[model samples]
Target chain A: MTARDQVPDGAATVWQRAVRARERADREEQLADKHEAIATETRTELHFRMAYIHRTTAARHRVTADLLEAHAVRTAEWTRRGGPPPLFMTGVAEACDTASVAVTLIDADSNQLAAAASDEPARHAQDLEYALGEGPARDAVAALVPVAASGTALRARWPGYGPAIESLGIGRVVAVPLQVPGDCVGALAVFDPRSATTDITRFVWVADALTRSFILGRDAGDGLLGEIDHRPEVHQAAGMVSVQMGCHVSDALELVKARAFADSRTVGEVARDIVAGLLKLG
Target chain B: MTLQEQELAAVFAQLTGEAARDPLDTQALLAALVESSRRLFGARGAIVQYTPGGAAAIQTDGTDGALQALAADAVGWREGPGHDARTTGCALIDVDVATHPTQVRWPRWSPRVLALGHGRVTALPLFSKDGPAGSLVLFTAPGSLLDERALKLSRSLADIAGHTLSLQREVSESRVLAGQLEHALSSRVVVEQAKGILAARHELTLEAAFARLRRYARSRQRKVADVAREVIEGRIELPTD
Candidate 1:
């Protein structure tokens, strides 16, 4: 594993900050329309709230920064010894106090739009759900709560998804909905979490922070392409396959996903081939 | 609804409307609070003293120049019903100022307050979850005190003021956080653009490009953003691995 595959804290923070800026700009515009005295009072309250949010956000960032810095130090030492260091998302998984974690962003239809995982197994788990379209994430979104299942319960509830996940050696799973108001953008899925009870709370907080402060705020303006790993090529390939197979784009996408699952390859790889004209769907 | 209930509901709706319009406008909320307190209690005048960014006071109409001066002096001296309410985080009343025992407590402040021709004063603490935000003070006519109904109404208005301040504070904080987020986003965007350029130029994956950029930044004791900027500007080059 190489360090390149990690979504750095710097990038996440930047994206979060941008979303916050847009919110502030809207508030500032509203403030301008108010009376002078009201504006003055509003300004003070705004400062107070800003201080509170800054303190909380900074505290959270400090912990992540320390963790990332320590990993960087270890990587540097290893590099000096001529060895490649571990990937970055592994730190995110560890930060959540879990061995494997996958953050998936879905659209209104609960279809997986993008996903990032701590490791290959975690990625496979997400892919399995994405292909089958049923799992903890879907259930979490449906219920708007944290969904946890271990061992028999996991398999029993999910049926196909459960058996497949167990095959990946993930006996326990936790999924927390990332939602704000009426909108639910995605779920954070943790596999084989260290402590289900405590990790659930952490996952809930992470999900809430991501939904309230980062994702939903951006998604309000269709500003999600920056952080999500959007597969435009896949969409293009789906469109092409739809024309060739005399099917709808949705059906074409399903066919592509089914083929990828059957071949035991990543959807990205198969989509690339389709787009490159090396493979065609009939 | 009874006439009283209908009147109260209308007042509440108006306050809520003001809040919805500009929830962070503390001064307007305070002004409205003082006016409501004065109108509900039929007091000689109403003053709201709060430590927003700093100590401040706003008073409803009908207060003479002398009374306004006394209210300002009370805050300045830090020895009045408003000051006490803020310090104790409790409602305070100095009824019948001429003979009230607490009148002795404000040695310098009470005399001026009484000289303003106000007989009684009440201060209700405005609280935030963290601590006391400030106090709402009301002045009744000389030799008179707010009746049970009037006091209750005043308390209700003060509570609304507290809610307004709290709501405004939240809105203000969110805006500031958003501003900081914008700065962070722009810097990250530059770094990301640099990564894309490097990845395409070297026929490397995005991840490999990021690793190289970060590694170079660490070696030079610089931010990855700085290194990425240099790369994008073609001032620095990364050897293909």
Candidate 2:
């Protein structure tokens, strides 16, 4: 037979045509025999993927909630355990993380703002700018709106913060502006040095969520202040990166940023190793 | 042909008959096509190009110089054997590059085929979803002919390759979305953990504890997650603000 005559029609072949026909017939027969089982398998696979996505989403929410919940839980533990009242800076610094944790309030002038930062050298790395009267947080506060630093491939945009931030080993971070409508004032900055994906897409989702929380928690602000434990490991890592890299504390902080991301390990874990003398940076 | 060759031909016909229409599945399709073609046609090298982009187009199994040249040249045809692919055009399938008739029909590409380790070449244009994706070409010694069966088999395999590529693109895009979702959730959990540490130590409300932490981070020049780790570690303590 000529090839044209032998070849079947369309996206399937002649033999496939027969197989598909038979399969369809058998499927109809099986539907009559066991329809529920087939449906169940389909349902099960769909549920598996849906559950995975849901679990991932919830995990993100839970961490943010945990920060809020820490207040009550830690207070009881401290009171129950009964230690001398922890120092205020110690408590606040410890609570700060790459997640949504730090705060920014406009100072007396209302035009300029001051920052209360966490102990993360990466996060603290940027506070130097606000301390020096310039940075994303400072601009966000003056602008009186949510400001962001989507630090991507080209980060020289933040001029002063860029080179300084680079030394802290941070690849990318975002500082969102928080202000009430009709009352443009200081802002809150949460610095997250992410190394997971190419973009700050996830960080943006989280920062947005935290900003909402800030707006919602505004009335509850005065009542929310609490004591936090100091995060020695992070500072220690910053110190180590500084010592090893022979850079300032800020530069040392940046070293941890690159290391934490490159190894896919947390800055904390790497810091632990440094403290224990398990690994060293080149 | 011998009985073995005929039997092999029959198996190929059956597979192509099955996928004669659809190129999506047909598992074990491409390798089978190559093996069958090599045996049936006594060819030296063959390329199956599907989804051709002039510059950005991606090809599978066409790691050869000729195919790369075709992509770079952006020409439709050169001479006796090569295939020229464009975004939109009549799919060209030249089954014999060294043959006299094809050699005379195309002037430029003929010598290039001789330069490439093969004396003969045939190029086929594959049309998928009614669009010009790319072409498939078979190369061989002077004795080889672009037989009907070999051409049919390679064409079918090319279809399968195209389907696989489409699926891969879909999968990669989904991964990007999934990664973003994961990142969002992790950051939230960390923030919450820091809050717990702050509240417990300072004897304050959760929100207030967060504010204090934010305040300290602003003052200390650090990241929020970085600060939270410290609060949990006791390196930097929080004050009751």
Candidate 3:
């Protein structure tokens, strides 16, 4: 099916979501004003803190609303022009002042459950991480915090993945964990971002928006606008290798990654070859 | 700032402070609301009937047992000014419990309120984004009536409390939904991996392997995902026919 056809909701629904976000932002702003007024009258530290909290929440909602509005506009343009579907991550990348952004949704154990990217470089970066079993995204998810590295620092942090991604001409990388209360669901990574854009506050806001509004929102059933690639073949290969070698699937998954890294290929490519009986590993 | 303004600011700080607390304590919030409203309006007693996200609660500010029991019964009976305010999403102020009209309106509740020595009552609607979520009822001594200023202040307090409660509920629901989405995604990944293992082991197609997994899970009265996990974990071995 065409990518445009894969969108779970029409532009109308996206616009509605944008409007709802704007309304929430307005409410939060009003609350912030109330708290600020009270704080001024009482000169109470508690009121000031409450005001700050409301203002922060209001800013987050405004960012989400702006992102949704941009997505809706792009979707409408695509609808009129009859082109490839507009990806949700494109707006996210633009908001971060970068052309390459990837989101990796992970399980509790930090294994990638699915991934989406704004461009091929971002996708390939995620693939390299998957195959090598290390990268900024993985570190962010594991640490539940933002991670950033540039130049030789990337290589120092991840010997195998750092050089490989640097070879792609990506000079810098930044990743922030997508966190909900009491749980970390995933991470968002940006590659070769503009200089000094990795201050991470804006990135954190975008990540929070993605976690709350897009991934867990009411229309989330559409599965991230159908852009997420689950890499089913990789998991399937892990299963096949587990049975072939009579080992647990988790170990089989590690073996698959090792094979991919040794052969200098993506885990997806290696998985496809194994699934087709063109390659075997014991 | 004037003395009254300072007092109002203190009340605002208390309510907002409680609202902004992490992992909000609903009981503490209710207590704060009751105490602030009673103190601000010079009422003898105050009760808060809050129902945020389908959970109903009623709390009073350390009042006598007989009065608390009557308030609890008022919620159940749905015959008091609080019930009227909640149902209509409007305030009922300066209501005299000893008046004939009040007695007729709340035949079972008014006389009992009078017997408790409260002559006047004021009920304010606690509003959320989704409409009225509950009510705050104040009981005052005989011949006392709240002026416009007091009513406005009480309304502001109720509004803040309602908004805070609803926001807390929304945050909790979002957290739950996020967890479920994560669980479902991981489960699907596990099941797909299991299918591959089964297919490779039995030299069968992926679809056939899935059927075998489902059949085995059903026979054992287990979830397919659970069976898939066991397969992936190497805890369950399926025989080749």
Q: How many residue pairs clash in each candidate?
A: 14, 102, 0
True contacts kept of each: 0.00, 0.00, 0.75
Q: Which stretches of candidate 1 lie above 4 Å from their native place? A: A1-88, A196-199, A212-227, B1-241
Q: Please, what is the TM-score per model? A: 0.50, 0.33, 0.87
Model 2 lDDT on a 0 to 1 scale: 0.46
Candidate 1 residue-wise lDDT, A131-226, digit = tens: 777899889988989999998998789987899889889989989987643456678898887765664666665565555444434332222223
As for candidate 3, its clashing pairs are: none
Supply candidate 2's per-residue lDDT for B160: 37
Better of 1 and 3 by DockQ: 3
- Identify the leading candidate in terms of TM-score: 3
Docking class of 3: medium
Going through the candidates in order, their DockQ values are 0.03, 0.01, 0.54
User: How would you order the candidates by lDDT, starting with the best?
Assistant: 3, 1, 2
Stretches of model 2 off by over 4 angstroms after superposition: A1-282, B1-42, B48-86, B95-110, B117-120, B124-135, B140-144, B203-241
lDDT of 2 at A182: 28
Backbone clash pairs in model 3 (N, Cα, C under 3 Å; residues 3+ apart or in different chains), count: 0
List iRMS for all predictions.
Answer: 12.4, 19.6, 2.8
- Candidate 3 RMSD to the correct structure: 3.5
In model 2, the Cα lDDT at residue A11 comes to: 23
Q: State the lDDT of candidate 2 residue by residue for A1-282, as single tens digits.
A: 133332212222222333433443343343223323422553333223323433443433443343334433444455566564322222222333343235554432542222334446533554445333456666665664445555453155666566666666665554555432223324445555333342334433333333333222322231122221123454455544444555554455556556765664555577667655577666
